[model samples]
Target: CIHDTRIIMTFLLTATFILGAVIAGVYFFIKRIYSYWCRKGVEYIEPDFFYGNIKEMVHGKISTGGLFKKFYDDLKSRGLKYGGCYTFFSPVLILVDLDLIKNILLKDFDNFINRGMYYNEKMDPLSAHLFSLEDERWKNLRAKLTPTFTSGKLKMMFPTLVACSFGLEDVLSEYSVTQDAVDIKEVCSRYATDAIGSVAFGIDCKSLKNPDSEFRQWGRQMFKEGIKGIIKA
Candidate 1:
């Protein structure tokens, strides 16, 4: 019994040592990458020790887009070409100079095509839609989908837009008659839902008439700006 107890204790000690060493290794590895920005003359706010730059984003403070937006404003104030921030310990270089932004978004688009956001298909299916796909796949899909959204398509859909606007105007007339304060965003979103449902899905969602419509409900629910919206800032 004494010998078995000694053997188990040894195994536990070894496991603890291994875990500690792995943790230490990761800490140093991340520190090394962070030091490069300091050397490159790019000013980065001292990343909250462990979380690097995106500490706020990770802790439900800002969205990925909002995080970059903050950096964009800060660097612009300093007249710097760009600056660096972290997204969950990964370095993100945000460029603000107009020419550089143009190059990244267009001139040499392939070099900076990826937005570096990750989404698991199983977690968000519709997100698994075109917006989530990256690399050449995203490029090809965007090209193919462009034709479906051209001015020609909008011209064809103009009649439907006219119909929906008429529906919306009539609905607003009813509200004006009642003298009630309806949320404009709610009304506009419902009109959009009805217009899109007809043109895209070929469904009649007479949401303009019925305020208690599922189409309107889902439209609002989709952009509710929840806690995730803050994190995604």
Candidate 2:
């Protein structure tokens, strides 16, 4: 009986040691991430142990827009010009001052040219647009696209715009007579899709007439994603 009791005591002590080590490891992991802003000498909001500052966002309790608004309001109320925030373990800088924003975008634009988004042109050529391109590539693309938006070009496209407006009016008039509750956003998106398709692609998407038009279907596919899809991405 004494031997059995000693064996049980030894097992309990080993279990306690393992448990303590695991807890300590977790604590250190979180502490290291939390130490980032402090090490940089930047003022930041204190984060919850597991979720950091975006607990609501990570849990899907608040939307992306709501999360940003919460951060903005919290910092703004404190009268901070700018503040450091965490999106999970990652640290982010939030700019609150209007004059500083104008200076960054206009007066000192070259210093912050890239939007720091990932884009692979070889894998997806369509992704190689003005928004994703960096440095000299962006400058070159801007110079090329500038000519397409010239006064002469816009004047040439005015007729197409007028035609699209008439088409939209006709589509809305029909919807008003038939449906009591029309999805205005869906209708507007369809109209815009058709208008751009005709003018730019020279192909009739007929999105207003046919709800499941090729262009609309393509657009739907682009935005479709599950949790797995997000994880993979």
Candidate 3:
């Protein structure tokens, strides 16, 4: 009985020691990651341990765009032209100056090409769009697509856009008579879907009149699935 108890105690101690070491190693690793911007001599917002600077976003308290705008405002208020922040220990640099943004996006684009987005071309072809492509792939795709979005093409599409707006107006007018609170974001999304469907597919989606239209349903489903995929990633 005494030998068995000794063996059990030794096993328990060894397991505890290994667990404690792993915990300590992970904590230090995270701390090191959080210091990335600091080591580069950049001013940065202090980050929380696990969630980093996106605690509100992680908790669904704020939209991603709203949170980034808030961060921009905070940095600008402090007279910062640029600043660093963390998204789950990944360092992100935010540029406040328009000139710097222009330079990075246009003049110095080659130096800042990678967007750090995830995409699997084989598994999900839609995921490999221009926005997520990097390096040579992005450069090549942008060159090919640039002609499609020229001024003349947009001018030709203007009438289609105007027609879609009329549908939006009709929907809003009905809601106005009923004095119902409107979800403007959803309304705009439907309008956008109708416009895109008309322009791209040469079909009237009628998303404003029929929320369950095939195109609108697919759009919503795609967005829902995309968000879930991003969160899981």
Q: Pick the candidate with the highest TM-score.
A: 3
What RMSD does each model have against the real structure? 4.3, 5.1, 3.1
Residue-by-residue lDDT tens digits, candidate 1, 120-193: 56765555446557887788877988798899998999998898899999988988999999889788988998
Residues 1-233, model 3: lDDT tens digits: 99999999999999999999999999899989999988999898899987789888777777778888988998899998999998876788889989899999889977776766667788877678877889888889989988878999999999999999999999999999999999998999999999988987799998999988888888887666333554643
Over all chains combined, what TM-score does candidate 3 have?
0.81
lDDT of model 1 at residue 215? Answer: 83
Stretches of candidate 1 above 4 Å error?
1-19, 33-45, 49-68, 170-184, 210-212, 224-233
Candidates in descending lDDT order: 3, 1, 2
Q: Number of clashes in model 3?
A: 0
Q: For model 1, where is the 10-residue window of minimal lDDT?
A: 224-233
Ranking 1 against 3 by TM-score, winner: 3
Name every residue pair that clashes in candidate 2: none
| Model 1 TM-score (2 dp) | 0.69
Q: Model 2, 32: alpha-carbon shift in Å? A: 6.3
The total of clashing pairs for model 2 equals 0
C-alpha TM-score for every candidate: 0.69, 0.66, 0.81
Please say which candidate is ahead in lDDT: 1 or 3. 3
lDDT of 2 at 169: 88
